[model samples]
Target: MKSPYSAKIVQPDISLSICGYSKVLEIVSNKWTALVVYAMEDGVIRYGEIRRRIEGISKKMLTQTLRQLERNGLVKRVITPSVPPIVEYSLTRLGESLLGPMRVLNQWTKENYSLVEQARASYDQAYYEE
Candidate 1:
């Protein structure tokens, strides 16, 4: 059976360049972008909530990352004209589409974390400890 998460493949077009792939990587590969996306997986959330959920993310970085995600059309920002002026953020349909691959990547990281740690230890022992 075909995997539900598997993307449909189209015939390769040699006329098109790989530049778009690099641009996407530049957007999603930022340090906080993935985490921000993951945080929104639950549903709509406020800015403070996102900041609190993502530990170690400074106000500036979170603000910048959110703006970048918005610019990329991956996230939506909503504002309420209440007395306190509430601001909320949520993943757009485009952003939701990314969750499948992100989940797979997250699982791979968890499964290989120990092996990665071992490699790091061996590398340090071979180089830094010598």
Candidate 2:
């Protein structure tokens, strides 16, 4: 059927099966999502707290990440009427459940960091040396 704008792009059956994986990649593969997941590991945190704990993140990026996380139902935004306003973010049950995979990824990264460093050093020494 014809819609308003552009034609559709069709794919093979195998490609269709990969859509689930693609969604997972889209959500968790992001830079800030990982950080937000790790931050929520301990418990709930206010918006400002999430910002403060994870450094080098501008307000725009922080807002974007939070929205993405919320969209995926991996995080919840709580707002309470208070002086100067109060907003907080916390993982939902679904988000909390992701702790296992997220933590595994974190552990793997930490454990393999030394190997990665060594590999980078070796590569530099072999190819980048004067």
Candidate 3:
């Protein structure tokens, strides 16, 4: 028997999938990646400063996130030949291009998070009452 609520599933066109949304999300969806990008967005910064700016991120996680960003061409790392070899991180042109969209999403979240919380609360209340 067919359910009334069941709807036909349609696959998205491959042409509409530019660069693969999942591939991009896989890179940016990590909890630490966005924070790390925002940390260096202001200017070139050292590894230690990035770790300090983002609270609760472990050293290992920070290192991994930086490497992933670098690997994706979104972040650039420069090592100065010094007695201790100073390393700095900065956003490349590609990374800077992402800022505009990210800012829009950030603004949307800031504006709608309260509404989302209210919806969640209402849903939970009704769900529990049932």
Candidate 4:
């Protein structure tokens, strides 16, 4: 199937813009980055809560992902004064901008996942099954 935007997508401007797009993809394409960002979509959340929300993510992995996101200016980390020093995370304006694209992709997956599974099965049967 041909995309409606294929003509525009193939233009020189797209080549010029790919460098910036690649950088964004490098950050967001990390296995845990999108999950961590989604966890804080509603509002400010603490470290433990984000960990709890994403099942099977290790403490170290979550911490590393959070730090990377903060470094990229996509997440804001605030430390509150307390005996234990509570740390909270929320999306910066740049991070909040990602929600729309993510939600659209999520919807696209829901609609097309069955087709993907069927294609994978066909490919496996052709090559892997012998």
Candidate that beats the other on TM-score, 1 or 4, i.e. the better one: 4
Per-residue lDDT of model 4, residues 1-130, tens digit only: 9887765554365553568877678889988998999999998999999999999999999999999999999999999999999999999999999999989988999999999999999999999996
Q: Candidate 3 — what's its lDDT? A: 0.90
Candidate 2 steric clashes: 0
Candidate 1 per-residue C-alpha lDDT over 50-76 given as tens digits, one digit per residue, 9 for 90 to 100: 999999999999999999999999999
List candidate 1 stretches off by more than 4 Å: 1-21
Global lDDT of model 1: 0.92
lDDT of each model, Cα atoms only?
0.92, 0.86, 0.90, 0.93
Quick one: best TM-score, which candidate? 4
Q: Tell me which of candidates 1 and 2 scores higher on lDDT.
A: 1
Candidate 4 global lDDT: 0.93
Which candidate, 2 or 4, has the higher lDDT? 4
Off by over 4 Å in 4: 1-18
Candidate 2: stretches off by over 4 Å: 1-20
Clashing pairs in 2: none
